[model samples]
Target: MTTIELTAEEMAFAGKIGFYRDYENKQRSNIADYDTKRFNLTSLQAHRLGVMCEVAVGKFLGLDMLKQPPEVWTGFVVSEHYEFNKGPDILNRFEVRRANVRTSPIPLRKKDLEYSAQVVQVYVPYTQTADGISVPTQCELLGWSDSVEDWPKAETPSWSKNGQARVVHNKRPMSDLEVMV
Candidate 1:
């Protein structure tokens, strides 16, 4: 049996900030031309933006099936000062000080596993809209592998000559964003 621990980190820099909201079915087509006013984002609001981005990407990559709700967690603190560009027009730029993954659990069978390693990831904010909506368009995941010298090695399974019975069960987590509306 082997145990594995995974970790991740995500960050966004030089991104534009704006206020945004979902468009109703009736107004979907007109959303692009709709007026989107900018506003100062609260600490919690900014944090949620990071979180939603993480969740969106995870769901896209099939990772949503791997973990429970709060599947991808995030903790963020906003920088004190907002960077505004004034040359052409006023633009708001706020930094999410430090946002990193706390824990990511990987479930696997204990047997047939030699050793496991930790996985770390970082996500950066890349795009923001005039509607105060932000999304992390860039993300990176790092996986480290190392040998466990002290643990006794288990015998390898021989599936070549012997007839074996195997049963596999797969389960997927329900999407959270789907129910938010």
Candidate 2:
């Protein structure tokens, strides 16, 4: 069984930080009707969060690398609310709710394949007022998805409040056109 541990610094630097943004996707027909403004984090944040998730999933799955070098740490999904420095004193609140470490298959140019491991995480954030200021009091990680697109589509696990679990399977067949043509 793998036993992964995180140093203080490692834990601090890793994990996804949610940010606010305006989403503009013409591909979605319904998107045009509603105000696009929403809180969203960057893809980089999401990827980092995935790493943090590994720490938890590794423990759950009992993988062997949890004790080795280049130690794998699962990703974290963090939901946070930050108030203007002048307006609020609370910085953030977060929780690691669900984590998963799993291997994904990748195709090689030589008609071979390899398995790459990744972590997924999900969480939520909430804020409330205290002492005349809004403060982040809760942040939760709900679950994880191996791929970016699959992340949202994945289901949360039963253990999580809104947890839905998702497993990715890469089974796309390779075309032979490039092998000879």
Residue 52, candidate 1: Cα error in Å is 3.3
What's each prediction's TM-score? 0.23, 0.25
**TM-score for candidate 1:** 0.23
Which digits, one per residue and each the tens of the lDDT, describe model 2 over residues 11-81? Answer: 44333211111121122332221122222333433334434443433333344322422212212211121
Number of the top TM-score candidate: 2
Per-candidate total of colliding backbone pairs:
12, 29
Error of 1 at 51 (Å): 1.7
User: lDDT, candidate 1, residue 52?
Assistant: 45
Model 1, range 1-181, lDDT digits (tens) per residue?
1111222332221121212222112234422211223224444354344344443344333443124222122112212221221110111111111123313221222221232311112233434568655544444322211112111332223321232211111212222112220
Question: Which ten-residue region of model 1 has the weakest summed lDDT?
Answer: 87-96
- What range of 10 consecutive residues in model 2 has the weakest lDDT sum? 107-116
